[model samples]
Target: MAILWKIDPAHSEIQFKVKHLMITTVTGYFRTFNLEVETETEDFHTAKRIEFTADIDSIDTNNDQRDTHLKSADFFDSANHDQLRFVGGKYESHGDEAKLHGDLTIRGITKPITLDVEFMGTVVDPYGQYKAGFTVKGKIKRKEFNLTWDAVTEAGSVVVSDDVRLMAEVQLIKQG
Candidate 1:
């Protein structure tokens, strides 16, 4: 029988990094997100179904002005599309590394994305909960998702880079 697992929000985080001013990097994170996985065994390599969703409005870049801009129509347009989702399509495992292929939907646009996953092993927590950890990394082009707003500095440097890197440190608790 397949066992269901839920993401432990307190132990998991979804973060992203992007180049700004064509010279510096800016990091941000989504404070609210959820991940669900269904597997036949304790081994995550056997995962059959994986789904994730993140609240766009929970984006925090530290700078209030930048956070507000990110939530505006120029970027995520949180008012119209308040959430981003991912549905797993395939799971390929090679030793301790894996690739998770899925369809990522942002601003209503669905695109194929593959995330590199590192199995961080599993353990029983002090409270007796079965837990698994993973490190996921991926990249996507903002323009491909209709996040085309941009500006050029007087010196010709771009305000933001087109590529965005996604990083996640996730902990999943096995459910009875």
Candidate 2:
């Protein structure tokens, strides 16, 4: 039988960094979201599957006003694009590391992406449950998703860069 698990919010983080003001970069993340994964691993031949989804409206950079502005029509437009989803992807392990591929959808745009993943191994938690952890990181241009909001600086440079870096550390609990 295969095993399934859900992401523990208290153990996961989703964040992004974008160049701002033509000199520095700003980072932010969502305070709430969930993901579920399934696996049939009893041996090397059996690989795991993962599905990730997120809520755009929950974004926070520690400022409520800025968060509200991000939800407006200029950025996420959360009312029209409430959810961002990733179709579960598979990775073949190579010496303790893996490369995961999937389609990431955001703001009505979907693009194929590849994430360099590392299996951080699993353990039996103090709570008496088995858990697995993974780290996934990748970069995608916001313009590809039509999220091209930006500003011009007096020095002839753009206020915000086009490339956005996505980084996440996720923990999946083992299901019986």
**Candidate 2 local Cα displacement, residue 64, angstroms:** 2.5
lDDT of 1 by residue, 1-176 (tens): 99999999999999999999978999999999999999988887788899999999999999999999999999999999999999997899998899999999999999999999999999999999999999999999989999999999999999999999999999999999
Tens digits of per-residue lDDT for model 2 on 18-120?
8877588789998778887766763322556667878988898888887897788778889999978887566767866787778889898998998877778
- Scored by CA lDDT, what does every candidate get? 0.95, 0.81
Q: Report residue 154 deviation for candidate 2 (angstroms).
A: 2.0
Clashing pairs in 1: none
Q: Give the TM-score of candidate 1.
A: 0.98
Most accurate candidate by lDDT: 1
For model 1, what is the C-alpha lDDT against the true structure?
0.95
